[model samples]
Target chain A: AQTVTQSQPEMSVQEAETVTLSCTYDTSENNYYLFWYKQPPSRQMILVIRQEAYKQQNATENRFSVNFQKAAKSFSLKISDSQLGDTAMYFCAFMSGTSYGKLTFGQGTILTVHP
Target chain B: EPEVTQTPSHQVTQMGQEVILRCVPISNHLYFYWYRQILGQKVEFLVSFYNNEISEKSEIFDDQFSVERPDGSNFTLKIRSTKLEDSAMYFCASSADRGRATEAFFGQGTRLTVV
Candidate 1:
């Protein structure tokens, strides 16, 4: 079974600054996918970024990027030029490469972007 | 962009009552899934459906829970008897394919409250 861990329960970042949320996972499967999801107070879960385990390069989407270290089993999310809209609960997820696309998620970190 | 849509943004039910959460996945998606997140907790996988049958399920999906694709476009998660612990935000998700490279798009989620 795969397990995702987000050590930080709460985080805060000043507006226009950068923030990094840490994530780690334990999975025996060699082929897998890592994802970062954001849930605002509105309760919508949105995909932030995703990284393929086989890819050496990290994934970047707008101001969101991931530092995917396959060897260390670490996938961290970085938000640059953070804005107030970036305040949300962030979750890290793991999925195997098989036919079943079920995701294993971390406890989540509540982020607050202060103005 | 195509996205998944879920009905009954919020549902309140009594204990032992039956409830069904509905979702309309992307038109081209081949894989569908149900996940739940208790307040202030991680998102947990419930079940995954493919080809109108359950392809995978987690321990949390017990006999009380079942999933069905009753029609061409609608996917449903049914809880035979709701419990207080069943109170959570249920999210429906779909992926274009079954590969790890493909990302799953999630719905806004339906908040279920069992009283």
Candidate 2:
């Protein structure tokens, strides 16, 4: 079994500033994928960024990036130049090698961007 | 960009009643999935459908729950007997391929309220 943990339940960031959401996972599988998803007020879950366990380099998508430390079993999401639209509930997810799109998600962190 | 669409943004049902949630996946997608998030809880995977059959499902997807791809574009989740615990936001997702090979596009969730 795999488990993802988001220690922060709530986070706030000033507009144009940067914010980092922490995530950790316990998985015995060596080959896996990590993902960050955002759920806005509309209740739509959107993919923010993704990182492969084999890739030592972190994944970056525009303002969203991840600090993936495979050895530490940590994959944190960093949002730069945060905007009001970034306010959402963020989830950290894990996909084991054997499963087809079976994602294990964390408790999620509610992020608020203040102007 | 192509997107996954779900029907009936909200659904209200009585206990022991049967309810079906609908979704229309992207035209080119090869995989479809159903997930649910209880208010303030982590998102949980329910089932994955591919090639007109279920490829994978979580333990939460018990015999009481069923999934179907009735048409070329429609995927549905049926609950034989709805319970108060079944009340949550159900999301439909589709991906171009299986496993971690591709990212998934999620539809706006359907809020199920069981009373």
Candidate 3:
């Protein structure tokens, strides 16, 4: 069983600033995938960033990037030049490469971007 | 751009009543998944389907819960007898394949309110 944990319950960042959301997971499998998802007030789950376990290079999507530490089992998401639209609930998810595409998600972190 | 779509953005139903949530995944995708979040809490994996059968399911998915693909495009989740705890936002997702850690696209969730 894989378990993902997001210790931060809430986070806030000023507009045009940066914020990093923490995430960690406990898994026995060596091959897996990590992801960060954002859910705004509209209630749609949007993909933020994703990192493959085997890839040491972190994944970046425009303003969203990730710091994936495989040995430490830490995958954190960093949002640069945060905008008001970035205000949402962020979740960390884990998926084993050997199994079906079953994603185990952490308790979400509520992020607010203020001006 | 193809997207996974779910119907009935919100539904209210009485306890002990059956509720069917419908979703249409991307036409080219082969893997389907169901997840739920309880009132802004963690998103929990419910079940994963492939090749017209269930590949894996979480412990949270009990005997009362069942999934089926009645047609080529429609995937459905059926809850035989809903409980108050069943109230949550249900998400439908799809991926191109399994084992590669491919990204899964999620649909706008359907909020299910059990009274």
Top of the candidates by DockQ = 2
Ranking by TM-score: 2, 3, 1
Model 1, A1-115: lDDT tens digits are: 8899999999999999999999999999998999898989875678888888888999999999989888899999999999999999999989898748888999999999999
Deviation (Å) of B43 in candidate 2: 0.5
lDDT by candidate, in order shown: 0.91, 0.92, 0.92
Error of 2 at B98 (Å): 1.5
Q: Candidates' TM-scores? A: 0.95, 0.97, 0.95
Better of 2 and 3 by DockQ: 2
Please give, as one word, the docking class of candidate 2.
Answer: medium
Supply fnat for every model shown.
0.77, 0.79, 0.77
Clashing pairs in 1: none
Q: Local error of candidate 2 at B19, Å?
A: 0.5
Per-residue error (Å), model 3, residue A64 = 1.7
